[model samples]
Structure formats: structure tokens, C-alpha cells
Target: MTSKIAVLGAGSWGSVLASVLDENGHDVRLWSYNKEQVDLFNSTHTNPHYIKDHTFSKTLVAYNDLAEAIDGAEYILFVVPTQVTRSVAKQVAEILEKNNQKVDLIHASKGIEEGTYMRLSEVLAEEIKPANRNSISVISGPSHAEDAIRKDITLVTVASRNLGDAERVQHLFMNSYFRVYTSDDVIGVEIGAALKNIIAIGAGALNGLGYKDNAKAALMTRGLAEISRLGTSFGANPLTFIGLSGVGDIIVTGTSTNSRNWRAGNELGQGKSLDEVIDNMGMVIEGIATTKAAYELSKKRGVDMPITSAIYHVLYDNADIKETINQLMTREGRSELS
Candidate 1:
């Protein structure tokens, strides 16, 4: 079955998804804010700035205009940065209202809003009118664009309050190399997806500091504990923290050089300033912003996310990384399960 899908955002993941959908025989319009990128994609079938050397399906089209990209689309997927999600949703709402159209909302972006701490789906719900949307869903897991583009065996979970909607998306993306699973733990999946980036940054920092596997292993384990603690506080299923979006995501993002968040933390650990790292990466390092939001959320929810707080201090307070590590190592001991 052929469907019209609009994928918003032109970053690495977004472009890869657009290409995947195109290969799935859907009419896909990829929207990018940059006109130059749109033109380049349309002309060359490649996103040189992000996914260099990877060719997209020729059937995939790129649009600079948001409304045009979404026109008559049945599925609207948001892959933009979390901070810009609300603004883009606002524009999408206006366009949908004007066109008297309704579409299912899906987001692949991962982060909590810095001030509101709302998840991406929550931000979409607040902006897009209920009348203008059918169902809201999220896609998340350990899959990375750099791997997926090579037709790597990638698996992800598509979750929605509505199981049928999740199944629908599962069919849309599943292929020989891409496998999709359905889950109903929206809160757990989304929380795991957003918070894992923070842990990944810590993992990269460990690598940058020449920490051994023992330290990396400890960081990842404790980081999952922090993720689960915070996630369960928000009514997420504890079991979901062990699923693909949770432990799997942390392992991949936290350890991989392909991860922008990990790379950013690596640079920071090597003594680069946050500004320097950001300017050099030329991509949104989600963990940096996510650390701030999660830090605030932990305080509001009174969750003991020591690692998140440590990363927050290093990134925001100019605290010495070594001192922060010492503080974490010296903290009073408690039950591991606590």
C-alpha cells in the first residue's frame, strides 16, 4: 500500500528515514529549513553535509516549504531538534488548520523541553490541535543513521497509546534490513530514548579520559539505574527500561564514535569548551541540552540522578571533570537496587 508521508528535518537520521520510506514505495517529501540543502538533495540525491557518500532513493523529494512538504500527507514525522520542536509544531498546526487536514503525528527526535520538561509528543499535543491529528506515536531504539545507511540489521520499537497505530508504523518501516517492533509503553520508550543520550555523553567522556572498560561498564550500569529511576518516577514501566529503547540505546549511543552526543562529550573531556565543541561538530549535540533539562527534571522530581548532575555540573558550571569524577566515586554507598 502506498501512502503519502512527510518527514520533517534533513539531518542524518531524518534523511536516512526519508530514504527508507521512499524505498518502501511511499510518496515521501522531506522538508528541510535550508533551501540549499533541499536543492542539493533534489539535484544530487545526497546530503553531503550530514550523510556524506550515501545516496538516497531518487524518488525521495526534498522541500524547503513546510506546508508543501506536508500537503496531503497522511503521516507527519518530526525529526528536528527537541528545542525547535514546538516552533515547528506550531507551524504544522497552522498549516493543517488552514488546509482542514488531519494526519498521524510521529517523532523520532529525542529530548525533554528545557524549560517545560515536556516530552516531544507532549509538545506536539500542546501545539497541534486535537482535531488536526489522529494519533501520536514515537519511534526509538539503538539504531544509528551511520549504521542504518549501510543496510545494517537495525531494529527499533514504534510505540503509541493506540496499538493499531504502532502496527501501522511498524509495517511502514520494516524491510529486509530494518525491523520494527510495537510497544505501548510510550512514556518508558520516550524517556529511555531521551535520557540515554546523557549517559552516552558520560560514556564518551570516560573514553576521552582514558578510562578502562571497567569504568565504562560501571558508568553504563549506573547510568541505566539513573535512567530507570527517573523514568519510573514519571510513571514509565520499570521493565521498559531494559528494553530496546533503554539498555540497547544506552549501549550504542554511549559507546559509539558515530554518536554526536558521545563525540561532543569526548571533545569536552579532552578540554574543549562547550562552545568550541558545538561549533566544531556542526550538529546538534542533544545530550548537552538534555543534560540541562534532565538535571532540572531530576530536581523537580527529586530523583537521585548523580551522573546526570555530574555531567550537568561539568557542562554548565565549569566544574573540573576529574573533581566531579572523584565526587561521584566518593559518594556514600547504598544498596545497588536503591
Candidate 2:
């Protein structure tokens, strides 16, 4: 039986995933807060906001109302920006209460919020009822929306407290071009997704600085270690950091031009101020916020994350890239072990 899938965000990733599910023969309701996006998807069969080039199928229905989008849906996909995730989940919880419907939640967003530093699923669990917590799953990995929309082969991980719930979503989203693996470590997956963006921004800075592959390689390896340190500090399995969501995701986001974090870093590398880069890009770069949150989390948990700290200082404290590099290189050394 086909599942009724509802995607909450209309950005590139959301639209791309909705398109994949539609092609796989599921009934997908793609929701958006904007009226123009709804009209384009429903009328012209194209998403002018994100994936403007791809043609959406008739199975993809665009909804402007949250209740209508969630009504009778078997599964909900949360794809909103990290900053708005909590608010949107609260709104969804209210609608579910009003309509008396219960469904599984699949989150694909990555980034920690400013104040809470909570992962996306944590924010959802807090906003929703206790009973709804069991149905939440996180879908994350190296999947980039730009390539996915073009039907390029991509791999990602689906994680949840319940393996069955994660596998259910794995089957729902897997297509000819997209593959999904399962992980019991949702916390690790979320950490990997959130932290990789900051590293990507750092990578972009290196690229902007005209550094070669040697610099990128060192940054990627050292950054992965720091991300794993933070994840382990939070009780996530350390091994999950080596899986698809960790090193795999870090490499994709840090290297790809399609990554918003990497692009933001690139602009910063080119000597543009943070405000200038944000204004020019005109999209939410998850790294900027995640850097700040991860920095705080690392300090609170006593985890050693020199790379994240450097990126944080560079972006937030107005520290120079050259000086940040010197600081990281001069940090106290420690033994490497599990």
C-alpha cells in the first residue's frame, strides 16, 4: 500500500525528496508557507522556489494549510530551516490535536537553534506529545538537493529509536537514484549533519584563501574528529561518526558547490563580510548557527573541538582566518584513541 507522505518545507531538499517519492508511486503532499510556490507546483507542475528546472508529477499535491497537509497523512517529513523547526513543530502539534490524527515524523533538517542548541528531533519531541515521540525518525546523510533533483545517485542514512520506524521511511524514500541505510544512532546522525555544515564553511574559507587539497584534507580529517568528540560526549555511539552521516556527509557538504554552508564559506573566503555573504546568498546557511551552538556544547560537555572553535571564532568573534589557523595549530596535543 502507498503511504500518504507530507513534506513540511518547500526548499530544494524538500522539493527534491517529494519528487523522488512521487516517482516511487507514493501520494506526496508538499507543503509551503508561500502562496506563489503552491501555485507553481499545483498549476505549472514546477517548483519555482527551489528546484525550478524539474517537472513535478501529478501525484505531487501542493498545500498551503498545515492541517490540510497533515490531514489523513500516514507520515510527515519535517524539512524546514533549523531556526523555524521548533515553531513549525508546535504549529503541527496544535493541528494534530485539533484534527485528532497521529502519524510518523521524518526530519531532514540539520542545524542547532540559537538558544536551545537542541537537535531537530529533540525540538520536535518537545513540541509534540509524549506519545508522538516514538514515531520520530531522522533522515540525514550526504544527500545534496541539487544533485538529487537531477536524479543523481545519492546515499543517506535513516535513524530512529525504533528501527522499524526508520526502515519504514527508508523504504518510503529510496528510489532508483537515492539509497537509504538504517542507523539506531539518531543522536550521532543529527550531530554529524549539524556539525558538518560548520566544517564545510571552514572548507569554503580554505578554498577562498586559495589553499590546495592538502589544507582541505587536513581540515576534513581534523573536523571529523571534533564532530565525533562532541557526539561521543552526548552519549552517541562513536562508530556512527564513521558511517554515512558523519565522514560521508562531511565530505559532501565540505566539498560540493551545492552546499549552502560551503558557499557561505566561499563568499567569506573571497573577503566578503558575514553580512555581505548572507545578503548576497539570500538563503539560510546552517553552519553559521551550528558553529555557535557546537562551540557552546563542546565547552559545556568538556569536549575538545579546536576546529569547531576556530570556525566559531572566525565567524562570530570576528577573528581572522590566518590567526584562527595558527590557534588550531598551536592547541595542546593529546593521545589519539577510542
Candidate 3:
């Protein structure tokens, strides 16, 4: 079933989704904040900003205006960074609401906002009035932009408050190589999506420290343990963290050098400060904020997230990496699966 899909943000992930939908015979409109990037999509049929080698389909259209992008959109996918989801949603809501239009929404972003600590859904609920909240969903999992663009077999989950809507979203993007699953666990989905980056940074740091797979595996596993401890406090299903969005995402992001979070962590592990690493990456690494948020969350929930706490100290408190590792190792011994 062909549908009208609008993808906001022309970054790697957004462009990949646009290309995927276009290849699936849907009417895809890709919205970009950068006018020159939009022009590149319009003229050369390539998104040089993200995927330079892959040719975008003719069915894909680029628009600089939000109105043009969401015009009659059946599914509006916001692919912006977590920090900007609210602002972008506000703009989207104003534009669509003014036009007397309503569309199903799916967010591909992952990260809780700083001060508000609002999950993407909370941000949507805030930007969109009560009337439009039900239309929003979050699609996330192990798929990376680079792999998705190459037509690899990528699997992800679309979580919605409404199970039917989740199913609708799942069906909307299921193609030969792209498989979509439906989940009603929005918190589990979003938390897993957001928290994995923190662990990825830890993994990257491990790599930078020339640590072994045993260390990476331990960090990755414990990372999710803490993620769930906090997620459960926020009403997420404890088991959902074991699913694709949780453990699945953690494994992929934590290990992949292509991951911005991991790359940033690698630099951090190599002795660069947070400012220096982020400056070099030249992009928003969600893990840094997530690490901070996780620190707060762990305190609030009384969950002993030693790993997350160590990460917080290393990043913001100037704790040495070797010292952090020693602290983690020296913590009171406990069963692995308690």
C-alpha cells in the first residue's frame, strides 16, 4: 500500500528513510532545514549531506518549507535530533494545524531533552495538543543509516500508544529488506533508543582504552541493566529492554565505530575532553546528554547504576578513565543477574 510520507530532517537517518520509502513506491517528501541540501536533492537527485553515493529515487521530493513537506502527509516522520524534536514538532504542529490537516507521526530521534528530561513522546505531547497526541509513534531499533541506505536487512520496531497505530506504522514501512515490528512499549522503546548511545560511548571509550571484548561486553550488559532499572521506574516494561529496541540497539551502537556516540567515546577514551571530542565529531552526540540524564535518573530511582555513574563522573566531573574502571571493579561484588 503506497502512502504519503514526509520525513523531516535531511540527516543520514532521515535521508535513508526517505530513500527507503521512495524505493517502496510511496510518495516521499524529504524536508531539510538547509536550503542548499534541498537543492542538491532537487537538482542532482543525491543527498550529498548524508548518503553521497546512493541515488535518490525520482519519487522523492525535497522541500525547504514545512507546509510543503507535510502537505497531505499520511505519515509525518520527525527525524531531527532529540534536542530539537520539540521545536520541530512545534513548527510541524503549527503548520499542519493551521492548514486543518492531521497526520500520523513517527519519530526516529532518540534522546531525552536536557532540562525537561522529556522523552520524545512527552515532547510531542507538549508541542501537539491533546487532540493530536494519539497519532504519534516512535520507530527505532538496530538499524544504522549507513546500512539502511545500502538495502541491508534492517529490522526495527514502531511503538505507539495505540496498538492498531503501531500495526499501521509497522505495515507502512515493511518491504523486502526492511522489516517492521509493532510494540506497545513506548517507554521501553524510547529509553532503549536513547540510553544505548551512552553505552556506545562507553564502548568507544573501551576501544580507545584498548580494552578487551570482556570489558565491552560487561559495560554493554550492565549499561542495559541500569537502563531498565531507570526505565522501569518510568513505567517501561522490564522485559522490553531485552527486545530489539533495548539489547538489540545497545549491541549495535556500542560496537559500531560508525556510531557517533561510540566515536565520541573513543576520542574521550583517548584523553580528549568532552568539548574536544564533540567539536571534532562536529555533530550532536546524544550519549553525552543521555549520560547526564541517566545520572539524574539513577539518583531519582535509587538504582545503583555504577557504570552510568562512572560515565557521568568521567565526562563532567573530570574523573580519570583508569580511576573509573578501578572504581567499577572495586564496587561491592554481586551476582551478575541478581
Q: Say which candidate scores most in TM-score.
A: 1
Give candidate 2 misplaced runs (Cα > 4 Å).
Answer: 132-134, 336-338
> Which candidate do you rate higher for lDDT, 1 or 3?
1
Q: For residues 1-338, what per-residue lDDT tens digits would candidate 2 score against the true structure?
A: 59898999988898888888888898889999998879878998887656757787877888999888888888999999999998899999998877777889889999887778788888988899966434889989998888888878999999999898889889998877899999889899999999999999999999998998999989999899998888988889999999899999999999989888999998888889999999887778888988999999888888888888888888988899887887877877777663
Of 1 and 3, the candidate ahead on TM-score is: 1
Whole-model lDDT, candidate 3?
0.88
Determine which window of 10 residues in candidate 1 has minimal summed lDDT. 52-61
Residue 330 lDDT (model 3):
95
TM-score of each: 0.99, 0.97, 0.96
List model 1 lDDT by residue over 245-336, tens digit each. 99999999988999999998888888889899999999998988999999999999999999999999999999999899999999998999
Q: Candidate 1's C-alpha lDDT?
A: 0.94
Q: Candidate 1 or 2, higher lDDT?
A: 1
Runs off by more than 4 Å, candidate 3: 132-134
lDDT for 50 in candidate 3 is 66
- lDDT of each residue in 30-102, candidate 3, tens digit only: 9999999889889988986567588878778899988888888888899998888888999888887787777
- Cα deviation at 287, candidate 1, in Å, is 0.6
